[model samples]
Target: MHSAGDPAPPPPGGVLWSLAGDIRGLLMLPAALTLQVAHPAVGAGVDDHSVFRTDPWGRGERSLRSLQLWVYGGEAAAEEGRRLRKLHRTIRGTDTRGRRYHALTPANYAWVHATGFPVYQHASRYLVRPLTRAQERALYREWLQVGRVLGLRDEDMPPTIEDFWPYYRTMLADEVEATTVVRELLAVDAPVPPPDRGPLTLRVALRAAWPLLLPPLARFRRFITVGLMPPDAREAIGLDWTPRQERRLRRFGAVVRVIVPLLPERLRYLPRARAARAAWRAGRGRQG
Candidate 1:
């Protein structure tokens, strides 16, 4: 239930609107999720409560949809925020280090959200054009607004882009670790099942070929997940990235940069984003 005075969703043409809905955004998501679970508390919550192992594709799809809604769902954004907070209320457990944890503890919850900014900033250097300094600040400000929509206080996040880096660095140094979930996410043999969505024929084909497909898919997953992470944060979490891998990632990104901008709107933007953008354009046309 949003009111007239409630903070608005990210504006339709904002940096988040442009980036969050873009297909390239999916490449950054695994790195962000990996970073989030590197924190023991977040790791434990997902390990114990999430069905990510049994339903990796479905989980990824749902998470991506929630992310899209945060920027493009308009009034639905605030309601989604409330639903997420409520969803996590009972997700309590002991982490790998035996520390008791709750999913919605301000710091833990905030850390999960916080991973997005750095991952976006870093990965954009390769997958999309680097953000200008002004664009970076604007992105951070808009992200903070999204935070507010998610029930985070002003104090829950760093107040500005300048303040955010130090806070992020401190978190990486003192708290982030290669927790069990982190290892699983980066594992090449983690036993993720074939995706169950799509046409029955496609699903069956995937299941039949999964044994042959999983090996390379897992390697690529690890490559993109670690390669897209901020370098210092990747080191902090102790993931290895060789120079050869770096070159490979750069070549891949170069291809992506050339190709993605050529895609049609319907192909480039996710479904929710494409629809919202259409609505915003129509409303603006009526006013004009």
Candidate 2:
């Protein structure tokens, strides 16, 4: 139906997920196509690092981690996303220090809001290593506090989830132990490249963060940001998308969520200062 000069466009798997008979799905795709990024582990971790699933559960701008869950299908499908719906139901928090939501403390929330230091985020009470019986008791108390904060019952905890398994609740060492885990997974194992003595810092970061800052362009920023940003800051804000792209993105994210649980377990425990202490001894040995 065309002349020699007119070349045919690529086919969408030969009309399966295709519509309108064009092949610009890649370019014409909407921005709200969120893609869920999961971790090496699965299960409850699915909701862990999720944005909008943040602490003080019903608090300020800070919420769960939702970087890749904006939409799931084409133009029509983009309308009924259930991200926030699932988010609110899963996260848990309450004012322990006082009735005021910020009574969890304005200072602590500020700490997490600005730098995401983890101490102020959910599950922080038990992040340290219990050195003695007393420390273990204190850690247990903190664990209880964390459970209260997350709205998790004793039955919902790591130890009892898939049945009382000891593998989930590993022994703790010290506060530094949790921090060390952070150092290992992100900063240590993936050291930041020395700043290019370039002319622009914002531009460089923008270049690096462009994928997150402007995800449609690249995914490098998203990968780089994994476990680096606070759960809240790592949200799933995006532009209006088409139904098809939404469905496609969601299906893709769902697959990843299945594989990685959409969130990392380490992030959940670390904010509450969860420590994987074996790394500490390993680290010391390396240095020694």
Candidate 3:
């Protein structure tokens, strides 16, 4: 600590610069953001107030806390109550298209204030909630609860979610990065399939992810909150709706039942459905 007139300590070598670099890394890595966006319980959309940007190195001067951020994610978000009012209109809409979910896609980048579906296929089981502004810093605090409830740490966050892309220019970059990585990873040998694979059911992955979140989520209140909604909202929440997500979590505790183990391990050498039936039979055989 120092008196008001004491000289300030030298900053960590480019600490501000390092943060800026991380911002670029985050902006350029959309998969991380999409993962977080799609993470546990697809949201109604990131609560509008939680998105913020603080620039410590502006050209003019050092005026900390003086940055007046706007609700400017897009044209529709420029005003304070405007965004929420509009969201209230849509979220409360009851028509067919109104009931339809509005998700962000590479093809529809121009849609203002748009967001992707609730990406967390198993999030309902975790009882995820929306984050407030203070929790939005570099997404550092947002993931803290996700990590704690889901048992994750700050370092575990994907770079895409950590960067703060305040305005339009970088938001585009965020999407580009998320889509590109998904494409490359979906290539022939990639562990995860590309988008054209028709939304690869991370259900298996979610099942895999369950073990990671169980300890916390179990002591934590698994499903009751999600099942509060009707069964139909599954797609809207971005879940593959594998049994693990839709069925009660207590039914899944301490168990990992491979939904369809007989499916061809390397694409199709035979009718995939037959393989599934055979797998089911075999599983029953062992159980019997």
Candidate 4:
């Protein structure tokens, strides 16, 4: 394990390095989570322990915070990874059909780890800037390196990004099953404004009228999530996608491309990315 004081080596200079910092990546959270839970074992683990139905936004935010720390928190990142691994070690249980599931199991862990590469890649290409083919390959490899930190062996991953699609397709075809948990996620069965966070104005409004707004918002989110998923994965989860949905999703992505770039850096990235950028500028200043 990497020591607390010792800086974990930086991730590769790749598309991930650019996309990891963009706020647009958050838009992929639902699709990524959907893919993760598409695997029966992974879904079982989440169904057993995750509080998504009660507090989905909190669950999502916590997941994002851990990922940000692991990917960008430098010297402290490895330690955070270790802590998470340790926590998950205690989360083992059987599914409704009595099949065993372990969150720490290597294959299960790797499945969740593998899903993020495509999510961020698509998020960048559709919402930020598109990467070159070589850059895409490099980004995929960087995530493989992250897999090592998350306790997955190299054998657990596809040999290359080009190879990953076949593996992903096979998983969707052979292993993914939509459980009740998947249905709940598709229903967006959790509160917005999180009940504990967000702007006071929004919080007050949501608290006042959440019952009226949540169903429509849930339908809207489900539509986008289905559009974001791969055809095979979308099919595995039985989400309906259509030409109209595709057009709307593309139109939304175009609007995001224009608006996101206009936001200030503080609003555009997570704190870790902002810190990384600040450090880079400071280092350049010293050399000058």
Q: Is candidate 1 or candidate 4 better by lDDT?
A: 1
For model 3, the stretches where C-alpha displacement exceeds 4 angstroms are: 1-23, 26-29, 37-85, 92-288
List residue ranges in candidate 1 displaced over 4 A: none
Error of 3 at 12 (Å): 16
Give residue 156's lDDT in candidate 2 (0 to 100).
42
Residue pairs with backbone overlap in model 4: none
What is the TM-score of candidate 3? 0.18
What is the clash tally of candidate 1?
0
What would the per-residue lDDT of candidate 1 be over residues 1-288, giving only the tens digit for each residue?
876766667788988889999999989999999999999999999999999988888998889888988899888898889888999999998988888999888999899999999999999999998999999999999999899878788899999999999999999999999988999999999888898989999999999999999999999999999999999999999988999999999999999999999999999999999999999999999999
Better of 2 and 3 by lDDT: 3
Stronger candidate by TM-score (2 vs 4): 4
List the candidates' TM-scores in order: 0.97, 0.22, 0.18, 0.90
**Model 4 lDDT tens row, 1-288:** 566444353463446656777788777778888888878888888887878777877877788888877677776677777788898998888865677878888878888888887776665656777777887888887888677666667798998988898888888888887876677778766555536578999888778887888888888778767777766678877778888888888899899999988999999988888888778778778999
State the C-alpha lDDT per candidate: 0.92, 0.26, 0.28, 0.77
* Model 2 lDDT, full chain set: 0.26
Candidate 3, residue 219: the lDDT equals 31
Query: Going through the candidates in order, what is the number of backbone clashes in each?
Result: 0, 35, 5, 0
**Model 2, TM vs. native:** 0.22
* lDDT (10s digit) by residue, model 2, range 1-288: 223432222111221111111111211111101111111111112224333223222321122122111111222121212333344443333222222222113222211211211211211221111135453333333433333233333444433222212321221110001122222222213323323343697657756864444333224323323322222323321112345644554455345335433345453222211222234346668999
Ordering by TM-score? 1, 4, 2, 3
Per-residue alpha-carbon lDDT of candidate 3 for residues 152-211, written as tens digits (9 for 90 to 100) = 223433334324223222333332221222222122332321112123575465555755
